[model samples]
Target: MDNQFPIPGPSVPGEAAPLPTPEEATPPPPSYQAPVSVKPPVVKPSPIKIILPLLAGILVVGLLVYGITKFIGSRLPSESVTTGQTITLTYYGLWEPSSVMKPVIDEFETQNPGIKISYQLQSPQDYQDRIKTALEGQNSPDVIRLHSTWLPLFAKNLFPAPANSVSATEVSTNFYPIVSKMLISGTQVYGVPITMDGLALFMNNSMFQQKSLLPPKTWEDVLSAAKTLKEVDPLTGKLTRAGIALGNTGNVDHWPDIVSLMLLQAGVKLTDIKGAEASATLSYYTDFVTKHRVWDDTLPPSTVAFANEKVAMIIAPLWRAPEIKSINPSLSWQTVAVPQLPDSDIVNWTSFWFEAVGKNSKHPQEAWKFVSFLASAKAQQILFDAATSDREFPQPPANKAVASLAQNNPVVSPFVTSFETAHTFYTASNTRDAKTALNSRLIKYLEDAVNAVSQNQDVVKALVTLNNGFAQVLSQYGLVAAPAAATTP
Candidate 1:
């Protein structure tokens, strides 16, 4: 009744709220009023609550990614580990796949499974240059096969063998004396000699027999044979057959061989064994070509002349034996030490090749192991057999014992004999510049003397010119020793 809906109660301020105490304010419950039909408040989910589950899922995913990253990192090989385990080696191709090296390499692999090797074969001509480039680029192979002639050039680039890996004195004692000396630089042995090749006189036996002459034992005998071989055509005044082909350009790149042979024969120390002097023992060489007129440029190249039977003699290595036999099986040829100089014992040029370890190699130890195995007596024996049989081109074994094993093989005997008396050229600094100067200028001077004689230039004049040039070269390299106030020849 009284406009019946309850009026809003805010009309009274705080004083009206004290009107009733809790006991007096209790209102009697409406008698059995129908239950209120109140609906529950419509509640909506919070955006924050929904986002929390998604955040937890994202966190779990991130942790899984982190764990995976860590697992992969742990499994990768460490750089240091890789560095300690691998080695790479490089060598020039000595023989094709069918030769002695194949089995040796396979055997080495079988014996050492933990160590891995990578082999690279290069042409002999390009090997040194390639090695030099690799060394300069800091990518050098751990091991290399070096020519004995080239050892001096590359000695500086090699790493000394690890101490105690081999017994230095014992190893040195195991090789031929000449072979041993070639591998020594001061007290350090920079290389291990694997094989050697020495100069030998290769003769056409049939030609010698036909000429009613025996094989030459002395330079004089050779001269006589050469003289008899030359004849003049009555009508043309032209020479028919050359007595000898002995020039640098011909099949004879054997200038060092000829020079060393003559020098040894003359009792000249190729190098001042004491390192006191550096001089070319050119007199004998000059005399041989000029005095005898044995080498005339008029003849065909040595290879052609020998192949065609136009010339009867060639100074070649044991390696050439097979090729000579192959060219003419009926040629009836034999090998002998280089003809001795007058009043001198027989001597020849001995050249030995070495296996060296590169300075920048990652696997120097492994590389050295391979080299050592190759130089072992067993390997040397295999090499000797292969060479003697002509299955592979022969190189003299560095091991004297191995060399002696070939004594019974006729084709190898002369080479072995020559190795006994052979000597090598002394390399002063073992530098490219030094080698180039020696090979280009010094060698050329000798070649020029040969050329002059072949062209009929005055021998004395040529010798004097060569001497002067030699002096200039020595001075250029600062190799000239102190001049004695009074020097004796």
Candidate 2:
């Protein structure tokens, strides 16, 4: 669907909000980090080693005793907690201040004084390794902050949001559809998101007025607009001015996600490793560079190009909006729900974070209680208000009621309206060797295919290689691996 919201002059014209810095939101999660290179990024491994068997046995015994103590402690009432009865629960969070979370955490603690919560913050890169190691050793935090796309890696160590705390029916009824889809498996609901965010097109208003062009509504319109807005050298046939940032890895922001948008919109079954639809989608996405010449290797990083007015359009989640504004607040731009595949059902890509309870927690029930409260409408509004104070725009609320009230917000309305149709995918962990990382090979190679196709490599062959690499990863994890095929469906 074409975003119905008209492009307003300037939403927040003055100083931009800096709640989520670019360093925080680049690739995948609403806090996505752009894969900055053709080579799939590998984060520095954590120094913690698996405990030795002798020590591990002792640790396990100690943890058992502690669990029993905490269980007994939890039996105490909130108003009746004494020194020995307080059930302290550890929590891990990313990208927000303690102050932001403190307000809600305070309320949760106040209502349940016996279950006191202790919070810790970690950088994303460090947190990924730290939490994984902690969970492996049974020292996992009581509650975890999970990305919608990252739960696949952490699922084994996490407890499903228990029915007694938050039922699957309540979850399905309260949050956007994607929330349940991403977090639920079989009959279990895994995590709950405090906010929801999906990719949207960020267009340069000055460029639009100068050329008298409306924002691109479909892929065809995008290509045509790319050609018209772009400037090229007559003799060298090299681009001097790029139209839209697409098809390349180093320059284009969130190219992996952009490819996901194309693949899903084209009805490619992403789980089918060797499907023909996957290859065709790759070719179509790369064609923006190879065929259209709208974007070239010479362009700067996408968000920068768009901010400097060197490009006309870029696709990113609402989180990226603050980044562009931080770079150049004076540059004019407005967001619209990402353009859809022409003549197809409306679809958009969403990537955001969620909170879940850890399986190993001594106080699993208490952890679930806090998680359920975090997803409630009352808590979500408090969350939105807190984030907005630090950011130019708040993350769209995941609560249907909360989102409905925000439907009038130009930036959020389109997203909230489209939440029912939004989709998400798993993000492969960047750690070199986790036995169960789906994104490690598939998503990274998907990025590699984009880089390859943009350089005029054969799209089929590239996809075939991507399929082969992806198959190896899937098979390693005991999943069924199929050979690549020539047909799209």
Deviation from native of the Cα of residue 398 in model 2, angstroms: 1.6
Total clashes in model 1, counting residue pairs 3 or more apart in sequence or in different chains: 1
Q: For model 1, what is the C-alpha lDDT against the true structure?
A: 0.59
Across 1-489, the per-residue lDDT of candidate 1 in tens digits comes to: 111111212221110001111121123576857678989999887799888999999999999999998888798877733535533455544333335565666667778765655556665554556667775557677766666555434655677666655446856678766655556544556677767777777777776777898878776677678777655568985556656665434445365456545544554343221110112234334433455555555666565567667677777666666666667666666777677745444456765557777776766777778777777888788766765564534666777777777767666788877766666653211112333545456666656765665566775676666656655654443344423355689
Expressed as tens digits, the lDDT of each residue in 334-446 for candidate 2 is 88778776545777777778888777777888899999889889988887777777776667888888886567667666667767887765532222323335555566777
lDDT to native, each model: 0.59, 0.71
Off-target runs (Cα >4 Å) in candidate 1 are 1-88, 92-98, 230-234, 247-253, 269-295, 387-393, 426-437, 452-489
User: Highest lDDT: which candidate?
Assistant: 2
Report residue 51 deviation for candidate 2 (angstroms): 62
